[model samples]
Target: MQKDKRYDQLLDRIENDRDELVELCLKLGNTPSYHAKERNVGDLVVEWFKASGIAASLQFITDESVNAVATVPGSGDGTSLILNAHMDTGPEPGPDATEADKKIDTAWTEGELIFGRGVINDKAQLCAFMIAARAIKRAGIRLRGDLTITAVAFETGAPSIDKDQGVNYPGEGFGTKWVVDRGVTADYALVGETSGFGIVRAECGAVWLKVRVKGREVYTPRLERGSSIQENPNAFAKAAHAILALEEWAVQYQKKEKLEFEGGAIVPKAQIMNVRGNDEISQASPFCDIYMDIRLVPGRKPEAVKKDVERVVRGLGFDYEISAFQYSRGHIAQNAGPLIAAIEEAHRYVFETEPPLPPSAEVSMWRDLNVFNEVGIPSICYGPPRQRDPYSGAGNRAMKISDLVAATKVYALTALLVCGVSDR
Candidate 1:
């Protein structure tokens, strides 16, 4: 049979297992592991890996639950070819007012949209890659390169609190000391993050910050002589003044530094993202916290950014507490890696059109691309653009089986292009 035919077969297999896949994603969504309790989903991934004839185990890399090396190795170089995705969902899984009132109700469709909470955020990608692994095994694939993969916990939780202050933050859930001892780096990584347009060559690294604004509190009705206007305003208005100051400073920071992005452009003239005041944890209290998201292009120092932002706060006459703390950075492989060429050529043969600009466009959104990048390995983002309309051909909600079929063909053909036309 032709290689393209086999690729179609793999995608079909995924379709065959669609119900199981959806069930798995739903289970993960319902786990309540969000960040603090992650053992449930981590164990589930291990079972799936073991079933695939891969040796798998779970461990605590950071304080959060994570996977040990899950591998399928034949006679080949140890440089693993990784298919990456995460196991964590966004916030706690519950219906908010916006989601409760959508008209289409695709999620209500049996075997259709399946929306509860994490239907789109990331569980879809995780399920896709897991199903892709099964399809590969079922399609009888043996590679010249090893394959290693992981879906870690706590990838979504954030906003650390000292805890000593008895101040717990939302989302991150009281700051667990999660550490990642990346066992081994892979030669190439496919993030499995809906890489439809082709390959995402570069990702902008991000740093989150907590910016605080402080003011004295006084009783209401003491309008003229009391500590604050807006009847104490939660004493938050003056803090708003400091917030404006930070924004102005960020604008100025744009003037001095810039990163040279791919496609003959510069990335992130200053920091890419900022979360301060009500934008951060503990909004109503006297202190306003903000998160600054810094998208770094490979070489910028995240520490320097911390100092600069702190300086900005001081210049604005705001007494601020700054901590560089934790961050999930960005990464890029050579504009074109070995498998990348094969992947591109495969898409060209199948699609019969030149791919869009950079092949895969990795967004500023965080993913395992940063994990491999931190460990000195080559990785890029690849897959379909399923996030665009939210409702594509298949169910008019998530990726159709047809979308998976197209992606599977691209994956197999890319394999053939790199491994050669041999029945391995």
Candidate 2:
């Protein structure tokens, strides 16, 4: 209704302004901050917001690389609405090593797609939101709620997952929780995660596991006599047994997810395995550690899975212990909330369809969304989406000309409606 009209109105503007958005993404992506470099990517996002007439600022969390922040302010609803993206990307951009540091590095571009480190992971999302903020300011529509955009760091690290430990919450860590503590209260939080035009209602939680296998060493002459090492304490053999057992348990866990959940597809179609990594054996040093990431289903708890993991290692009858453990609380905010409905209405207005629905199955990797969700925020993740264009497997990183135009229409319409523009 209201959303459709808004999209119809904003479609042209979204198309007109995409190149600017892509340029912003490239310049900033080149910043070493893509990983955890000294420079802060948040700095660039903040600059874009303020430069475009939005009230943007940085809230310092610390003096170190982890202590940075970025925000863009909006008008309306007295209550603030959040548009957030983590400032960090895993395996951050490597040294540019050359000057062609252009936003769409031709050297990095492949066919229709733009290429570069950190180009897709998140810099794209940040750019999309920045462009949206700029468009709203240029158009003069007032919002029902104030729009606040935040870009921060260290989302790829472990401490970043604890929502209860939000920034400056009198705790010692960085995460979405920290963003909340630093005054990012909003009616809803939108994670710009490149999920095409849909929302991610359920975020799969993660549990980190490290299994250690120690073996006894014996000389070949005495291998037969070593009680623990009839075959020199066959650590490899023990590891294989443990891995096989864990695989069996993981399968059962996955099956449980299929029967227990709805919506999204359980992809890669199974749990990830780091069954046995970094193994070593010598006459002097004999031990192997199997490190793995366990992405639990929305309703599943790592604690519940912990016992299963323990049972498997124990069932092997080999000595083992759970070395380190951490888990993310799963989350799903009713997509029908006034906030989401309005946003989706805006999306439908732009896309001319119901817009992609949220995924039902949890994603396999961990993300900052866990922090907001764990602490009870109706958090969901989304991002501009484009498969490899017809020309190739990639396209624009920030605003796929095709997807960006569509997303920009959605963003503009959603912003206008959510911000409370009285008429189209």
Candidate 3:
């Protein structure tokens, strides 16, 4: 974990600019970047890069949102690195906000914790990467390999889960996939998720399935008058039966599909997220849609998970069709990969000890680390451990300012080591 003087200087710079970093986190959290609507925060990210003299631009994925991409070019002799962080956050406090939600949703530093949605979930990491970039620039250190940062969009929500919502809304990985499709790749990628400063070498991927039940549509009055309930065939009620069957299947499937790896482990899960039937309350609905969220362990295929669901639903004697609406295969990287090694070195230097690695159950949360690892560019997640909302039991919902600074140091040092420093 011995770092060059340049790397040490950069860490010092990050420490000196702690107030500016906090401001960036607050600014991003205050700006509402809900789901795919990330224009405000994305644009601000791009502006920060430009103002810092870094090469910056917008990778437009949709009419409304763009990925904020910036780079510190290198001399082309060493390995390149990518620092990826999502621009979006989870749901915000609404009109009926609890006192805790109101307090934590707004980013601020009181003692050690920085209470906010964006800072806790991801935007804090985004700011950390930005500070790392600034520290490098301030030290006037040139890298032999390139370093790129992306503030991506559409991470908070899934893509195209509901047909009624239209296919135009391409869901999760929208931003990161766009970056890859546009050929913005590197030798490795570092995802700044809430990994608790530990290296996350594996994470579960998700498969979203939509099941539709079909039957005859009839008026309730006719069924009440002479027809039997079976003749009227309420698809909604039949879907209810399928849900109960799915619950039973979930218990068995999760146990059967459980997997453990050296980097982490996962208990593949199936949960019914939504059920939709009649548009009008008075009408007898002939169709019902069941939406399921299935988390897949690494090496598990979406087709297999779909088949499992089909088996349970078909066994219910209901006329139904099931399809995987969305699937993201989980990703796993070796603990000895360059990405993990650099992160470990930096983490040890920052904390003066080896970082803790989470167990399988603890590291099962999904992030874009899978995106890079799936493409053969080794990647891992390393960042601050998320704080829980004491009142709401919300996980990955808060952050400590000190932890944020520590992560910033790790990010900067890792980039220096992996990218290699040069005199230009």
Best by TM-score: 3
lDDT to native, each model: 0.55, 0.58, 0.80
Across residues 141-204, which tens digit of lDDT does each residue of candidate 2 receive? Answer: 5565677776766666433222424332321115466678866676666677767666665666
lDDT tens per residue, model 3, 1-424: 6656766777888999998989999899888886667888888998999999999999876766778999999999989999999987755458998787676666776677777776676799999999998888888888999999988986766567544365236666667878888999999999888876678888888888989987768877665422442333778777777788898888998888887766655777778988887677877777998999888888888898888789887777768898877778787774337777788888888888988876455467568878887787888888888776563446447688888998999999889889998866
What is candidate 1's TM-score against the reference? 0.72
Put the candidates in TM-score order, highest first.
3, 2, 1
In candidate 1, what are the lDDT values of residues 1-424, reduced to their tens digit? 2346666666567668766776676666555455445567778778877887777777664445454346655347333466666655543533652443232222322333344334444555666666666666666866666666556555566545444122122232111122234344456666666645556666666666666656444345543433533334443565566567667766766555444455223345344244334333433445555656655555667888888878777765545576654565565556346867766776776577755644222453455666665566666666655532343223223544445445545654554344443344
Ten-residue region with minimum lDDT total, candidate 2? 164-173
Instruction: Estimate TM-scores for all models.
Output: 0.72, 0.80, 0.90
| Least accurate 10 contiguous residues by lDDT in model 3 | 223-232
